[model samples]
Target: MSQNAVVDGAANAVDTQKGDYPDFMLKEIHEQPRVLRETFAGRFDAESGRLKLDELPLSTDEIKAIERIYIIACGTSYHAGIVGKDMIEKSARIPVEVQIASEFSYRSPVFPPNTVAIAISQSGETGDTMDAIAIAKKAGTPVITITNVAGSSMTKESIATLQVLADQEVSIAATKSYTGQLAHLAMLSLYLGQERGMLSADEVADAMAELEQIPAQVESILSETSIASIEAAAAGCYKAHDVIFIGRGVGTATCLEAALKLKETSYVHGEGYAANEFRHGPIAMIDAEAATPVVAIAMESETRERMLTIMGEVKAYGANLVALATEGDARAAELADHVIYLPQIREMYLPFTAIVALQVFSRQIALLLGRDIDHPRGLVKAVVD
Candidate 1:
C-alpha cells in the first residue's frame, strides 16, 4: 500500500481520542507503568521465585527439548525481539534468531527439530507475521505468540499465546505496547530458563526483584521534572532534519526503537547505529555546520567509557551531543550538551526507564514542529500488509 493510502485509511479506521491527555502517544507513554504491571501480574510465583506461565502450553520437557528459537516480527516488535534474543540466550542457554517477518516469509529458512518460533505483534493481525507463523507451523514447529489482543488471528494460529495486556493503543506510534512486549519477553525468558535448569530459583528471584522495580522507575521518568528535562533536550534537536541515535549491547535495541519513534512522529530522518559502528562511516555525517544531533545512550555499562570517548569525538566534530546517562553521572553531564538522566538500574533493565525519556523527547519535538503526534501522517496503528 502507498503511504498516502495508509494515512487516509488510518484516519477512518483508528481511534484518535486524547481524553485528559494532549495526545494519544503521550497518553500511551504515561500508561506504561500500568501496562508493565498488568503484563507481569499472575505471571510470577513469589514463593518459588519462578515464573508461572501456565498460559504457555509448552511443558518443562518441551521447553528443554527446544534446540533453537526463532523470533519473527517487524518494526518495533522486531527491536523488542532483539532485546529478547540477548535475554533468552543468557537465561535459557538457547540460541535465538531475530528476523523481520516480511523478509523471513520470503527466505527458505531451515527449522531444525525441536525448534520453536515466537511471533510478536502489537496487533495480532499483522499480515507478514501471520504469514511467517504459517510457515513455522508448516515446518512442524510449535508457535508461541506475544501480542496485545487476545484471540486475534496470530493467537488462533499459535499453540500458545502470551498477551502483552497493553489494552488499546490508539496512537500510530506504539508506546505502552512496546513496553508490554518487553515485560512479557522478560518473563518468558525467565520461565524458559528455570524450566530448562539454566537459572536457579535465587537467580530468578534476584531478576524478578529488579524487574518489579521497573514500573516505579518508569513512573519516575514520567514525572514533571523528568518531562521538563526531556522537553529541553528535545528542544535542542527538533529543528534538525536528521538525528543519530547510538548505543551498545542491549542499549542498541533501545536506540533503534527511539529512533523509529522520532521518525514516525516528527517526520525527521532518524537513524540508529551501534556505538562502535558510528566511527565506521556514520560519524562522517556529523558536521559542525549542520549541527546534527547525536543522541548517545551512555548509561553505566561495560562500554560506557567507550561511549564517552565516542561522545568526545562527536563534540569534536561540532555536532550537538545528547546523552542518556545514569542518574548522577558527572562525567556524562559534563560531556553532553543536553542530558536526560535515567534511573540507576542494571544495564539490561535500563531499556524500561531509558526509552521513556526518548518517547517523551519524540513527542515534545513533534508538538514543537506542530505535527500530529497521535496519528502521524502516512502511518497506521497496524500494517496488515
Candidate 2:
C-alpha cells in the first residue's frame, strides 16, 4: 500500500511507532531493500527487459519533443533529483537541470518549448516544491511529480504522479524514501530512453538486470558484519567537528546526501564538494591538528582514479580519510585511515550501495553524539511552510 493508504499518511505519520529498531532512522535505513523492491515491483518485465511505467503520462512523441527537463526539489529530495538528473540525461540523451525548489520558485526560469518540470518530494506537501510546480504549470509545462505519499498536494497538482512506494517514511531524516526515489528515477530514465530510441533493447535489458540485483546487494551491505564495521568506523570519526564528502559524476549525489545526513543527524559541520572542485578552495580547511574527517566516495566509477588522487591530497594535508570503496579495493585501503567497503555495482547505480553505508555511518555518529537521530533539532519531516 502507498503511504496514502496508511493510517495517517507521510505528513502526519510523525508519531508512527518504531516497531523493533531503537530509532526510526535506523529502522528506515534498514528498510531500503524492501522499499526498493516495492518500488520496482510490476514496473519492470524481466522477460522482455522492458519497463512498464504506465504511470508516466507522456507519450513517445511528447517525450521526444521535450527541449529540457528541470528537476525541482528540496533537501534530501533535492539530492535525489541530482541523481535523477544524471540518470535521465545519460540514458535519455536529454539535458536536465536540477534546481533547488526554494530558489527555483523565486528565479525567473525560462520554460523552453516542450520543457518539463519534475518535482520530487517525499511528503508531496513541501511548500517550496509545490510552489515551484505551480510556477512550472503556470508556464503551460506539464509537471510530473515523484512523491512517496499519494493523494497529497503535489500528486493532485501534477499532471502525472510517480509514486516511489516507500510507504510512510517516519524519520525526519529520509532513508528508504530516498532510495525509492532513485529506483523510480532509474526506471523513468530507462523508460524515456527506450521510448526515444536512445537506448537499445539489449542495453535496457542489461541495465534492468543490474537494477534487479540492487535489493540483494543492499541486503549484503546491511548484514551484521558490514553494519558492525560501519559502526566501528563511525565510532572512530564521530568526534570530528567537521566532515567533508567528495566525489564526481553520480558520486556527487552520493557525497551531497552523505554530508547532509551527517550534518543533520550528528550536528557536525559537513560539506560536500566535487573532488576536482575541492582543490580550488575547500582543500585549505584540511590540516593535521584539526584532523577533519574527509569521507571520500571512491565507489567504482570512471572517476575513481581522480578520487584516489584527491584522497592522496587529503592524506598529504593530514586529514583523517574515510574511504567508501568497492570491496577489496586495495588502493583506497592503502590511503584511507578507515575504509567502509561497499558492494560493487554499476558506476551510475553505486549511489544506492554507497549511500546506505553513509546512512549507517551517520546514524552511528548520531548515536555516539547522543543526538536525536530521528527527529533532529530544527528539522521537520516536511517543510510545509
Candidate 3:
C-alpha cells in the first residue's frame, strides 16, 4: 500500500503524522523517495514499453509539429526547467529554450506556430510565471503547466496539467516539488519522443528502468550512514563565508539549486558556475584568507575529467574542496579534502539523484549556522505578488 493508503485498524488512516521527525524541512526532504514513486506510479507500462502522459493534451501529430519549446518558471522551478531543457531536447529531438518568467514577461517574444510553452510553478500562483503564460496564450501558443496543486488557477488557464503528487510541501525550500517536476518533465519528454518516433522502444525502456531505481538510490543517500557523512562535511564548511558549487552538463542544474538552498536558508554567499565558466572569473576568489568552501558535483559524466582539472585550480588557491562524487569513484575521493558520494546512476539522470545529497548537506549547514530554516528571513513562501 502507498503511504497515502488507509490501513484497516487506523482511525485517521494515512501518513499525515510526522512521527518523530522534528524539522518540516528534513521530513519533506526525506519524503522525496515516496513522493517520486507516487508521481510515476500507474503512468508507465514496462512490458508493453509504453509511457502514459495522458495528462498531456496534445496528440502525436501535434508533438511532431512543435518547432521548439519555451519553458518559463521562477526560483527552484526555473532550475527544474533547465533540467527539462536537457531532457526534452535529447529525448524528443527538439530544441528547448528556458527562461526566467520575469525576464520572459517584459521581452517582446516571437515564437513560430505550433510552439508549446510550459509554465512550471509549485503554488500555481507565481504572478510572473502566470503573466508569462498569459502572454504566451495571447500569442496563440498552447500552454501546459507542471504543478503540485490540482484545480489550481494555472491548471484552469492551461490546456493541460502534469500535476505532481508531492502533496503539501510546507517547507519554503522546495524539496519534493523540484524532484517531482524533474520526474514529470522526464516522462513528458519520453512520451513526446515516442509519439514523434524519435526514441526507440528499447531506449525508452532502458531510461524507464533507470528511473525506476531512483527512489531506492535516493533512500540510500538519505540513510543514516550517508547523512552522517554529509552532516560531518557540512559541519566543517559551515564557517566559510562563501560557498561555490560547480558542475557541467546536468550537474549545472544540481549546482544552481544547491547554491540557492544554501543562500536562501543560511544567508551564506553561495553561487553556482558551469565547470568551465568558473575559471573565467570566480576562480580568482579562492585566495588565502578568502576561506571559500567549494562544493563540486563531481559525479561521473563525460565532463568528469574537466571537473577534475577545475578541482586542481581550486586546490591551487588552498580552498576547502568537498566533492559530491559517485559511489566507488576512488579517484574523486583521492583528490578532494572531503567526499560526499551519491549512488551510481546514469549521467543523463544524475541530476535527479545528485541534488538530493546537496539538499541534505546544505540544510545541515544551515542548521549548524543556527538559521531559521522553516521561516527563512526576507523570503516569502510564494512570490504571488
Candidate 4:
C-alpha cells in the first residue's frame, strides 16, 4: 500500500479523535501504560491462577505437544520476539527461535512436527511477515498471530489471534503497539508455562501479580523528573554522529529497541550491541575525543555487574557515557556521566521501564534536532510488499 493510503486509512479510523492528541507519536507513546493494562485485562486470573488465553488457537495438549516454537517478525516486532524467546524458553521450557520474517519466508527452514509458528505484527499487514505466515500455514503448521488491527489480513489468515487492539497507532513510528505486543507475549508465556507444567500454577499467579504492576511502574517513569532527565540526555545527542547502546540478558533486547528508536526518529547513526559482544572488538573503535554518546543499560539484574564493567570500559574511552540505572543503583550512577533512574523491578520486565526511557530520549532528540518526530524522513510506517 502507498504511504498516503496507509495514512488516510489510519486517519479515517480516528478522524473524530485527532483533535484529542498533540502529536500522533507523542499521544501513542504516552498511551503505552494504558495499552499494557488493556492488553492483559481479564486475560489473567491471579486468584484462579489461570490465563484466559483460550483465544489462542492451540489447546493445552497441543501447546505441550509442541517440540519447538518459531517466532517470525520484522523491525520492532522482531525485537519483541527476541524478548519473547527468553520469556518462552525460561517459563515454558521450550526451545524457541526468532527469525526475521523476510528471511524466514525465503529460507525454507525446517520445523519438527507440532512446531508452533507465531507471527507478531502490529499492522497485521506487514507483507514479509504475512508471507512467512502463509508458508507456515501451507506446511500445515498451526499459525497464530498477535496483531493490533482486528480485521487485518494477518488476523483473518491465522488459525487463532491475540488481538492487541492498541488503539489506532497512527504514527509512522510505533510506540504503544510495541508495548502492547510485549504484554500479549508475556501473557502467552505465562499461559504456556502453566499449561506445559514448567511453572506451577501458584508460581504463575505470583508472576501475574508482577505483570500487573508493570503499568504503574511505567507510569512512574513518565514523571516530570524522568522527562526532564531524558531531555538532558537528548541535549547531548543533538549533534552526535553516532550513538551506541549496550546491555545484557533480556536487557540486550532493550538496548536494540532503544537504539532503534533513536535512529528511527532522530536519524542519528545509532546502533545497539550486546555488552560482551562490544568488548570483543567493537570497544577499540571508541575514542574519547569523539564525544560519542554510549548509553548503557545498567539496570539491576544478574548482568548488572557485567554491564557496569562494560560501562567502565566505555568511560575509560572518554566517550559521553549515560546509564539507565535502577532507583537505588548507586554504582551505576557513579559509573556514567548521566543517569536515568528507573524504578526497581525484576530483570524480566526491565525492558518495559527501560524502553520508555529510550523512547522519551529519542523523541526529545528528534525535537531538539528539528526532525520530524512522527514521520521521520525517508521512512514508511510498514514495509508492505
Candidate 5:
C-alpha cells in the first residue's frame, strides 16, 4: 500500500480493534495526557518564558495590528475555538468572533481590513473549513491555520500555519487534538497578550508556569483512582433523554465540549448553556427527575459566585448536578449532587484540567451503553469532502 492507503487502512482498523479496553473511544480517551505533553514539547522557551511560534509567519507589528479575529472551525474544533475566543479576547484584548465554517462560508460575513482569520482543524481536510478559508482569503483577510497534518490542504493553502502534532487521530471522536488545539491557542493568546501590554511580565510568567505543569497534571488525572467515580456517574446518567451542561468563562467552553462529546458519542440529547443564561429561559427545562445533569466549571474568579447562584437554582428545581470545582471550593461541592474535585489552577488555565474529566466521562458512558466508543455512528476521522 502507498502511504495514503496505509493511513486510510489504519483509520478503518480503529473500529475493528478490540481489547480489554473494549472500544476505540476508551483508548482514545485515555491517550489524552500523553498527547497533551507531546503537543507542548519544545514549543515553549522556559528561559525567556515565551511561546516559540517560529513556524508561524507573522511579524510582531503584523500581530499587533490585528484588531479583529475570526476563527472558523467545525464540530469539536469549533468548541475549542469558543474557548480560544474567550481567552484571546480577554488576554490579548482583541475582539474575536468564532463561527462554524459551514455557516460562515454560506453567510459570507463581513471581514474588516487587518482582520486575522484563524482556521482550526485536526484533519486539515474539512471541506467547509477549507472553503471558509478560501472565502476569507478572497476577501483579503490574512489566514492562519492550526492543523495536525503538515502538508494537508488547510496548511498548504493558508498564509501561515501551526501544526498541532497530534499525529494520526484515528478515532472519530476527537480527544487529544481538542486539548492540543486549546493548549496551542492558550500559548498564542498569552504571547499576544504580553505583546499588547495586556498582561504584565509577572502574569505572563505565572501563566507560563501553569502551562508547564499541565502535562504532569493531566498525567496524574489519567493514573488517579478518582476516575472510577466518573465512570460510575456515566453509567447512571447515559440513558437520560436530555442532559444540560453549564459553566462560566472558560468553564463554559468545557460545558460546550462535554455536550458535544455526549451528543456525538452516546447519541444523547445535550445542550450547553452559560450558567448565567439559564435563568433567562433554559431553567424551565430543569425539573426533578429531569436528568438535567449540570456540569459547572467553578474557578476562583469573580464568576464563581455567579456560577454558584446558577447551581443554587438548579438545586432548588431538584435537577441533578455534577460540579467540577477546585479542591477548596466547599460551596460548590455542597450544592452539587456529585462533585469532582480538580486541582486549584489559575482561573484561565482551569479548562485544561476540566476537559480531561469530561473526556473520561464520555468514554465511560459510551462503554456503559455498549456502543462503539471510538467510531460513533455517522462520523468520520476526517471530513474529506
Candidate 6:
C-alpha cells in the first residue's frame, strides 16, 4: 500500500491518533471560525489608522503606489480572488483582474508597468500558480503572494507575501484555507483602501471591528441548527443528476466554489452562475423532470431583492431552490423550497460562511453517494498543472 493508505489505516485504528475528530474534513470545518478569529487578531490597529499586517513584505508606500492589480490563483484561491477583486475595486477604487493560474501562465497576457500581481495559493507550491508568478516577474510586474504555507515556492518567489495562517489542511477539498484566504484578502483590501485614501478612518475601523468577530460568528453557525439543515440539503443533492448554484455580487464567487466542490467530489454535473446571467441563457435548461437542484445565496445587500427575484424564477420553473440566507430573512425563506439560516456577516465576509455551508453540503453528498470525500476520482489534492 502507499504511504497515504498506511497513514489512513493507522489513523482509523487509533481513536487517540485522530484526536477525538472523525476526519480531516470535520476538523477543518470546525476550525473555520477559530481560524478566522486568529487571522484578524492583532492585525488591525484602529488608533494608527493602519492595518498592521505582521510579516508582510510590502511597505505602505509600495501598496499605495500600485496602479493596477492582477490576482492569479488556482481552485479555491481563484474563487477568493473573485471576491477580492470586488473588495479591492470598491474599497480601494483600483481596477483589478483575477485569472486562473493555469490559464494566466499559458495565455501570455500583457502586463502593464506599475502592475502589482497578487498570487494566491494554499500550498504555495502549486506549479501553475508559481509559473504564473514567474511569468509576471519576468514581465517586470511586482508580485505579492498570499499563501497558507510560509516557506513554499510562491511565498519565496514574490516580492511580498502574506500568510493565511490556516496551519495544516489534510482534506483534499479545501475548507479553513478558503476562509483564511478571505480574511487575509479582506484585510489587505482594507489596508490598501486606507492607504489610497479611498476609505476613511471610521470606515476602516468599523470594518476591522466587525471582521474581528467573524470567527466566533462562523463557529456559532457551524455548531448551531444550520448544520443539520445543510446536511439534509446535501443528502437531497446526492441523488440529483445536476446541481445549479446561484448568487449575485460577492455571492457569485461563493456559488462558483460551491459548484466546484460538488463537481470535484460527487462527480455530478454542477454549474454556478450569476443570478442575473441566468436569464440570459441558462434558464432554458431548467424543467420539472431532471429538474436542477439550485443553491441560492441570498445575503443582505443591494442585490438581495434581485437575488430573491431570481430565486422566485427558479422555483417557478420547477427547480428545487435551496436558499441560504441570514436569520429573519422572511422573504428568502418564503421563496425557498428549503432554507438554511446563516449568521449576518459583512457583505465581503458572506462568502466565508456561504462556503462553509457548501463544504458541509458537498461532504454529505459525497458520503451519501459513497464517494471518497478526501480522494475524489481523477483528482489530486494539488492540481500541479
How does residue 148 of candidate 4 score in lDDT? Answer: 79
lDDT of 5 by residue, 1-385 (tens): 0111101111112234445666666666666676666656676676776666665566677778888999999988998899899889989999999999989967859988789888999988999999898899889887778887767888767776666756667678888788878987987898788777788777877777788788887766676566876776676677778888888888887888898888888888788888888778998887686666666777677689888888898888878888887767889878987777777788877888888888888777777787777778988788867
Each model's TM-score?
Answer: 0.95, 0.95, 0.95, 0.94, 0.91, 0.92
Which residue pairs in model 1 clash with each other? Answer: none
lDDT of each: 0.87, 0.87, 0.85, 0.83, 0.78, 0.81
The alpha-carbon lDDT assigned to residue 338 of candidate 2 equals 90
TM-score of 1: 0.95
Candidate 2 Cα lDDT to native = 0.87
Which digits, one per residue and each the tens of the lDDT, describe model 1 over residues 1-385? 0101100001113344777998788888988998787666566687767778777766789889999999999999999999999889989999999999999977898999999999999998999999999999899888888888776888878777777767788889988889889998888899999999999999888888888889989999999998999999999999999999999999999999999999999999999999999899889988789899999999999899999999998889998999999999999999899999888887778788888899999889899999988778888888898
| Model 1 spans > 4 angstroms off | 1-17
Global CA lDDT of candidate 5, please? 0.78
* Count of steric clashes across candidates, in order: 0, 0, 0, 0, 1, 0
Write the residue-wise lDDT of candidate 2 on 12-54 in tens digits.
2333677788998988888889877766666667677677877
Return whichever of 2 and 5 wins on lDDT.
2
Give the winner by TM-score: 4 or 5. 4
Which parts of model 4 are misplaced by more than 4 Å? Answer: 1-22
Query: Candidate 6 residues 1-385, lDDT tens each?
Result: 0101100001112122336766677778887876787778887775686777545545567667788999999888999999999999989988999999889956777887678898899888999898888889889887787877766767667766677767777778888889888887899889888877889888998899888878777776787487888887776667888889989989999999999988887888888999999889998777678667899999788889888888998899988889999988999888977888888877877887888888888888888888877777887777666
The 10-residue segment with the lowest total lDDT in model 3? 1-10
C-alpha lDDT of residue 101 in model 4: 96
TM-score comparison, 2 vs 4, better candidate = 2
Model 3 residue 291 lDDT score: 59
What value does the lDDT take at residue 159 in candidate 5? Answer: 72
Model 4 residue 43 CA deviation (Å) reads: 2.2
